[model samples]
Target: MPETVLIVEDEFFIAMDLQLMLEGYGWRVMGPVGTVKDALLLLETELPSVALLDVNLGRELVTPVAEYLKAHDVPFAVATAYDRPEQYGGEVLAGVPNAGKPTDERRLMAALMQLTGR
Candidate 1:
């Protein structure tokens, strides 16, 4: 079965583009969800194989969602426009992979592929 990927990005266009790209590669995309609350709500019902998390969700950070995913053993890649992760103040994200926004499909795919061993 194709793995499902939850997308937690605040930007609508970027999320939609990512959904299309992942779907094109035969992935089941769970969401292009814009907020941490909505993403967490979905998480309560569905467990995705992996997640693509944007560092910032408007004024909020994705650190809490990342923590939930980590505790559940769900792999995730951080997608962000920021060059430095220190600005986010999450030590848990220290060694996690990054997918960098305006995301490059190759890098994103590669990161997810590596995470899932696909």
Candidate 2:
């Protein structure tokens, strides 16, 4: 079975772009969910092999989702415009792999591979 990836991003275009890219690479994509509530709801149903999270989701932060994923042992990477997402996400994101915004394909794929060990 193809590995599944959960994507937590608020921006519509960026989420669509990421969905297309990951699908093109032959992996199953779970969500490009925009909120912590949605992400957690999805997680309750199924766990992805890895996840990609955007640090900020409008008025809310992605920290709670990150914490949930961490506790579940689900590996994930952050996609952010910030040079240091940890500043916003706190210690939960200290050493987590980051796939910077504008979403470079190479870096994104590398982070995925690192997370999945594939």
Candidate 3:
């Protein structure tokens, strides 16, 4: 089976673009979900091989969701428009892989491929 990827970006257009791009490469895209609460709910049943996480989910930070993924050993990468991760203060995000927002699709695909070894 193809590697499954969960997209946790909050922006509708951005997330949709990512999802479409991943799907184009034959990856199974799980979500383009837009909040901490929704991410958690998605986590309840959908466990993907890799996750693309947005640091800020609308108003809520993704630190909690990161913690959940970490505990479960599900590899994830943070995608954010922010430069300094220190500003977020999420314990779970320390040393985790990340990609900047407004990132190119090929680069994002490469990151996800590296994470999933595909």
Superposition error at 63 for model 1 (Å) = 0.7
Give the per-residue lDDT digits (tens) of candidate 3, residues 8-92: 9889999998888889989898877998888889999978898989888768888888888888999988787666654793667
For candidate 2, give the lDDT: 0.93
Q: How far is candidate 1 from the true structure (C-alpha RMSD, Å)?
A: 1.2
Q: How accurate is candidate 1 locally (lDDT)?
A: 0.88
Higher-scoring candidate on lDDT, 2 or 3? 2
lDDT of 3: 0.82
Give one digit per residue, the lDDT tens place, for model 1 in 42-81.
9999999999999988899998898999999999888887
CA-only RMSD, every prediction: 1.2, 0.7, 1.5
| Clash pairs for candidate 1 | none
Highest TM-score scorer: 2
| Backbone Cα, N, C clashes tallied per candidate | 0, 0, 0
Model 3 alpha-carbon miss at residue 97, Å: 2.1
- Which stretches of candidate 2 lie above 4 Å from their native place? none
Whole-model Cα lDDT of every candidate shown, in order = 0.88, 0.93, 0.82
